[model samples]
Target: MRSILAVFKREVALYFRSPIAYAIPFALTLFFGLLFNDTVTRNNQNAPADVIMTFIPGLFTFLLFLIAPLLTMRLLAEETREGTLEILMTLPMKEWHFIVGKFLAAWLYYTVLLALTLVYAGILWRIGVPDAGIAFGAYFGAWLYGGAVLAMTLIWSAVTEDQIVAAFLGAATILVLWLADIAAAWFANLSNTGEQNSVVAEVIRELGLRAHYTFTMAQGIIRAEDILYFIFMMIAGLFITTRIVEVRRWRS
Candidate 1:
């Protein structure tokens, strides 16, 4: 427990101290602003707070693919590159401790980034206060969504020693997931009433990150299943990360 806290503290501090955190968040905010502004300005020209809130969470989904890799690309790869991982392995702490702690730190960093986006709420407030229930749901959904993305990228970090390789793998994997969502949408829209095709609909729905993000969050309906799905994904990814680190240690 003590060792985990030590690692967590160190990693949390490193993220704040390093320029990587700022660089990624700034890029994300820039992209998000462009998208949200375009939607609000064009579709609902001179819209109210509730309408903008509806648009922001959906637009926020795009950043998951672009910025999530930044959180995990350095986790184990940097240690391996610097030869620090070997020394850490020789210490009293086990692999899972390091893995979970680092994962938590990264998770917290991403979660904070999501929270900072509440400034969007403030912006909305300047126009008019939106529905509190819907805004809360949207924020909650975005938080879990970010958690799942960070966990996915952490898996890439555990296996690869090169940061570039890790980042590429992370981004490519995310891109595939995004593409799967699009394919599912196409399939889902094929049938009349979007039903009568159970197999196709089920497969497509399962692959949809945006389905959960848009309906559950932006629509202000919190679903237990979606939240649990993200929790399961995050835990599964980190567990695999621990296993990979353990195997790497055993090999040496």
Candidate 2:
């Protein structure tokens, strides 16, 4: 536990010190601020009940596709590239401890980014009565969504010593998953019957990152399955990362 905390604290400090950390929040603030302004302006006198939805579904998810890779690309990749991973492995700490600590640091950093967007929500509160349930669910789901993304990207980081390669792989994987639903739709359309029930299409849609969040959490309808999907992703991602690190340690 102490070893984990040591790594966590070190990584968190490193994150705050990094220019990318500040840059992400700055970008998010500008993007969300503009989005909220435009949404409220277009709506005029009556704020939409689903104002947050405007931010979550499309651009936000895309941002995650980009941001997840940027944040995690250097996590393990830098360590391996610099040959510090072997040094760290020689310590008394367990591989899972190191992985979890790094994961928690990155997760906390992403959480802070999400928290910064709450200012827009606070603005919605002053002007109108937004549905608290929906707001809560959307943000909660987004948090989970980001955790899953980070975990997945960290796997790429674990596998490669080149940060650029890790980042590219992470982004490509995320893009594919993010657009899985669209790919599925295109396949169905090609069938000429508009058959959404093709077994292949169904599986593709289910694998989409948006499928778990857009309809359910974005709409304030929280389902156990949706939550579990992200939880499973996080757990499985961490497990895979741990195994990779363990294998590397043995080889070193």
Candidate 3:
């Protein structure tokens, strides 16, 4: 526990000192600020009941596909590239503790990114009545989604010393998971029966991260299965990353 906190503090300090960390929040705020302005301008007459709903989907896509990769690309990749992994492994801490510490640091950073968008929700509340339940669910869902993505990206970061390769693999994995439902729908359509419940389609849809998030949390319906799916992803991702780091530790 002490070792984990030590690593966590170290990573958090590093994040603050890194230019990319500052740049991500700055860019996200600027882009979303423009989007909020445009939304208000277009819906001048009637304030949208839930302005959050209008852009939550887009936010999910942007964060998952673009931001997540950049955030995690250098976590372990840069360490390995600079041969710091050897020094880290020489420490007395367990491999899982190191992985968990790093994961928590990245998760906290992602949470801050999510929190920054809450200003939009507060503004919507002042202008119009937004559904608090829906907003809460969306943000909670996004938090879990981001954690899962970060965990997966961390695995890729452990696999390669090249940050670009890590980022590419992470983004590619997310893209495939995001588009799984669409591919499933296409498969159902090609079957020529217009059946949405084909076995293959159902299986594919179940495999999609978007399906789990969109149907449940995004709709203000919290389901155990959906929550479990994300938890499973996080656990499995971290488990794999631990194993990879263990192997590297042995080699060093």
Candidate 4:
């Protein structure tokens, strides 16, 4: 526990000390600010809920791909590249401890970034009534979504010593997940909606990152399946990361 905290503290410091760490959130703020302004400004007739509900979920999904790779690209890759991973492995600590600590640190940083987005919701509330449930749901969904993304990227980082390679792979993997719905769409278009096609389509849509949040969570409904998907993906990623790190230690 103490070692985990130590690593967590070190990682938090490393993130804040670096100027580049702030760049993605800064960009996110700018993009979301613009999006919110445009949404509210253009929305004269509808309730503020309409604008917010429409914007937040899609934006969160879009931002996930961009932010996850940037934050996690260097987590383990940098350590390996600089040969510090070997030094760290020699310490009297378990691999999961180090992995969990670093994952928590990155997760906390993403939470901070997501927190900044609440200002947009606050602004909407002041202007007009927004659905509190939907707003809060969107935020909760984003937090979990970010965790899943970070976990996957950390896996990529664990296997690769080059930060650029790790970042590219992470981003690519995220892009594929983000577009998973498209694959479903294509298959549906090619095949008639029969029992077989329906089953295939259902499976494909369920595998995509967008449908779970867009259909349910974004609409203010929290389904257990959606929540579990994120949790399962996150744990799966972390588990894979731990194994990879363990293998590397053995080889060293």
Candidate 2: list runs displaced more than 4 Å: 45-47, 52-58, 189-197
**TM per model?**
0.86, 0.92, 0.93, 0.94
Candidate 4: global Cα-lDDT? Answer: 0.85
Write candidate 2's Cα lDDT for 1-252 as tens digits: 999999999999999998878988998899888877888888756657566443643456568878888889999999998989999988899999999999999999989988888887788778777788888888888899899989999999999989999999999988898889899887777745544457778789888888888778877889999999899989989999999999988887
Q: What is each predicted model's overall lDDT from 0 to 1? A: 0.80, 0.86, 0.84, 0.85
- Compare the candidates by TM-score and give the number of the best one: 4
**Pairs in steric clash, model 3:** none
Candidate 3 residue-wise lDDT, 8-46, digit = tens: 999999998989888988988888888887887788566
Across residues 1-252, which tens digit of lDDT does each residue of candidate 4 receive? 999999999999999999877887798899889887877777756645655654765587677777788889889999999999989988999999999899999999989888888887777777778777877777788788888889988999999988888989999999888888998888787745777886797788888888877777777778999999999989999999999999999998
Candidate 1 regions off by >4 Å? 27-48, 185-197
Alpha-carbon shift of residue 190 in model 4 (angstroms): 2.6
lDDT winner between 1 and 2, please give it: 2
Candidate 1 lDDT over 52-91, as tens digits, reads 8866665666667767887889999999888899899999
Task: Give per-residue lDDT, candidate 3, residue 177.
Answer: 86
Return the TM-score for candidate 2, rounded to 2 decimals: 0.92
Number of backbone collisions per candidate? 0, 0, 0, 0
TM-score-sorted candidate list, best first: 4, 3, 2, 1
RMSD of each: 3.1, 2.2, 2.1, 1.7
User: How far off is residue 27 in model 4, in Å?
Assistant: 2.7
Residue 236 local lDDT, model 3:
92
Better of 1 and 4 by TM-score: 4
